[model samples]
Target: MPSLSEVISCLSDYDPNALPVAQAQQIIRDVVTPVEAVEKVALRSALDRVLAHDIISPINVPQHDNSAMDGFAVRGADVGPDKAATLRIIATIHAGGGFDGEVQAGECVRIMTGAPMPQGCDTVVPQEFTQAAGEGEVTIPAGAVKTGDNRRLQGEDLKAGKPALAAGKILRPADLGLLASLGIAEVPVRRRLRVAFFSTGDELRSIGEPLDPGCVYDSNRYTLYGMLSRLGCEIIDMGVVKDDPATLSQAFRIACESADAVITSGGVSVGEADYTKQMMAELGDVTFWKIGMRPGRPMAFGKISSNGRNACLFGLPGNPVAVMVTFYFFARDALLRMMGAEENRLPLMRVASESPIRKKPGRTEYQRGIVATGADGVQRVRITGSQGSGILRSMSEANCIVVLHHDQDTVHAGDMVDVILFEGLV
Candidate 1:
């Protein structure tokens, strides 16, 4: 494994104090490595797991040329170009059944969808396009179907001896069905990543705890648990650690010992307590940075070691919204890499803005937005009421995040802006 310093040395323009969002992402990508462990899991249990090896198809996907509709399979030469031709229907073939005899000229076979094409038959005319002329006879109209029409050719979906799925893919529902189609009962996948997270503050209390003056219930840990669970990580919720040097140090050590990554929301920014930062510095090669991004700016990132075991650490801001934003933008990809998953960045779509948005040019801003189709039948986005880092309600009410790039200034009401949607059609 390459050290963080070695990775940083390779970058030409690296800054720890005032890091660009893109640069910070690149740095994290270069420093993190995938975990090297594999386990065989049943196909149903492998959903959301990263595939460890490429899966090659053992046989053609369709296995043989088959009918794609309920129709009469016949030789193309049997149907004339200018007039309808009547042919004797010799046999009927269902989905799992096959015909043994060859289909000769002036003869046809009634075939159901997915039935293997009989020998010497190349085209199928749908039952709706054909008429039962008499007993055991069907008439196919001229120009009903060309040769090879309505037939699913062998190996059309996936060819034998070719890769069906590549390594590092996070298996989804469709992937499971694809593997099932290839007769794959078990799959090799990387083990689930172990993540331990906590919150730090003297004024933070857990649920059911007595509320003291100036203390609020800690929601960061609960949010982290949900997010990590969605990513298929084994979570170790260390709860809220008190704002004390020894207690924080002990919590950090314990987290590093048991998990592949550690996350804490609080104590990394200026004006907060210094013990968390001081202890983090002593325990690891962590770098605290003020990222050029809205809602999430102050972040601490690096690897920390405890008793010969090391884990990646992400110190996010104390604000509720800021913690969620930093986790999604930075830590999400890094953790996916650690788990050996190769996923592309979520696509940002362009849509018109419903109202003018105030933004600065120096920092990237992610404002919560409500995307809706207006009376004009065009999709447009409007920002939520409050974009403050502490306003978690804004995030809940939003269906997407309106992204303002680092070089962009204020946006007009009708201008197109990029947005990342939280919900998808699938």
Candidate 2:
């Protein structure tokens, strides 16, 4: 008999500060999980990892101003429409060497891209623009010669002691080059978050097992495993546990002990055989159940005491697509919270609708849809087929979920709906 708001309120009251998704994020903003001190790891091992602490540049990127192009480093007074200056191409400054001699007026240095700028040289005319007419003589183009034309300013990438990356920031491929620019051979990164999930249903059987008259092959666990892997969680799958309370409790214990969070499919709804809810409450005060959302009416969240730590537990609905969607919207945020990720919500874009869709008030709906481009250069979306939770293929072929808020009852063509594109559809 608990309303959605009431359940959220109760959960807020249950924990000291952890509110539901709406407010929980705010409450946990400053509350970062324990960062396991900085561990210096080789740069090769730092890719696709989160920074454990802020990293400041020990040296200026590029070390010093250098030539941005292979050209003649010269003074602005050296080139003009009056006539070509007979400048001696003394020593070629090829990247590593510093031009020792001062570049006098009407003199230039042959420099390559990434070569350090000589002490007195300020401008560079590209080699193409300059023609070598004779020995120790090059043609300077008669054009608007601006001062500091091709100077690669020192600290252009980053200044010494500048914050190159902040703590808790997720690193990308390009970040490696930045780290290298800072001369960081090793990086301090946070430990990976551990997540364990399992599937539970009496009518479920493994793929290899013979299907019974009323049973179906278990797909929730495999799907969840793949999804969690993509989310960067260390997974420990407990396989398929039956509907029995003892078996479910044991499996939950295993997950709670070894994982940062425990996720289980099935046995979360208001069914007579449903035991996950009760077992969660018995194990370690499960805060609430039954969110006000379509395809995820039976979601439970809370903690389960196992070993020394209280691992977070999420009881997802049994439907394969429901499990996936609910996890993406609801549990994924929480798991990211545990991982100390700065951003919780995925990027959602507003896309116009090509067709209308049915809906009812009181629950938010995530209808699968195909997103296509319109002549107006905006993404237009339409529901692929049935908005049923069991339709997994519908979600597969679709590119995004056109999110319908709980307040909206119907959507018309050309109406704008918040669309969340599949993370890896490309």
Candidate 3:
């Protein structure tokens, strides 16, 4: 019998031969986490990247109270219901210009949208409501408009020294526009997570090469590279490597030395040519492997400290769909945690199923699905004909993934399932 300490080590150790998906996700979150560091990046290059620090507003948006309409800035007290109050449009104010004179009780200032409201003017009537008959005079309608109806108050959008953007938020297009409104020319963001990827197997070939009878072209790395780049990660596609320990050891060393994280496809299962797992074990400690799932059950994780830098590693399944799913479930979260992302889970949406679907009760499944609105304006989803891990075309056309968790034993035609939106991914 082994000693108690040896038994504890045995139980705690991550076995690439028998790790589950949840276990894998947890291990990744624990082993490789984020530490805040700043990188000065252009606004154009900061999309989808996590903010390393909070952004404060330097100037009050709209610096002063202004008109939201292009009619006239008037003293509302002087205008009566259904009464015509004639006033001299003392001055015209276009965008980027303002009225100079103060408005008397019955006077008005002709103003355009975004123009500063004249002094003593509190409301704006749209040009459509006022009839302009002369060079500088207009009639105010007797049907009195509400005060402040067409005015954008000073500092309404943002106040100086206010938190414009909270740290850890992922930047989107709207965020960029908001930052621009705050007059921010540059942002301090987390430097892109340097990611490296490759595929393995003696039975893999590059797309340009003639296909061998028993081999298939490698596509996982390309897909991984593209998706990671879209997520604002700097990717290094190391290409394909054969299923040999020596070559893998050298390649792994390079990836560990250079990238913040390394990803590979295939050669991680317990088979004769499964050299990646063993090679990784030799180079560094593999966190876990072997998630309980369909199609792509074999996965691997580890940390490698070599050369100049240390990196986290992931080994996805060989099949195309498996590789994509594994990345979403595993590496995506890992990258998020490493990037100081506020959201731990990816964005998900709920949709009702239009037709009955079959599923087993062992593990979770992500089926490619198309989402459309029914007559009631409710989103209904229908799964593609095949959800096989190799069905790349179906995955391409899908807009969502219908999630089937382990505890969900059955689903009916109208049953609701939580579908992860893949609109941007596709």
- Which window of ten consecutive residues has the lowest lDDT sum in model 1? 271-280
List TM-score per model, in order: 0.97, 0.89, 0.90
Model 1, global lDDT: 0.91
Residue pairs of candidate 3 with colliding backbone atoms: 81-142, 82-142, 82-143, 83-142
Ranking by lDDT: 1, 3, 2
Candidate 1 lDDT over 1-426, as tens digits, reads 776778788878787767889889888888888999899999999998999999999999999999999999999888867889999999999999999999988999999999999999999889999988999999998888888889999999999999999999999999999999999999999999999999999999999999999999998998888889888999999999988888999999999999999999999888773666678778998788889999888998889999999999999999998998888888999999999988657689999999999988988999999999989899999999879999988988899988899999999999999998988410
Tens digit per residue, CA lDDT, model 3, 177-294: 9998887778988877888888988888987999989988888877887779767787888889987788888888998888888998887666733455556657776644567676
Report every candidate's CA lDDT.
Answer: 0.91, 0.76, 0.80
RMSD of each: 1.5, 4.2, 4.0
Q: Per TM-score, what order, best first?
A: 1, 3, 2
Q: After aligning candidate 1 to the native by TM-score, how far in Å is the CA of 368 from where it should be?
A: 0.4
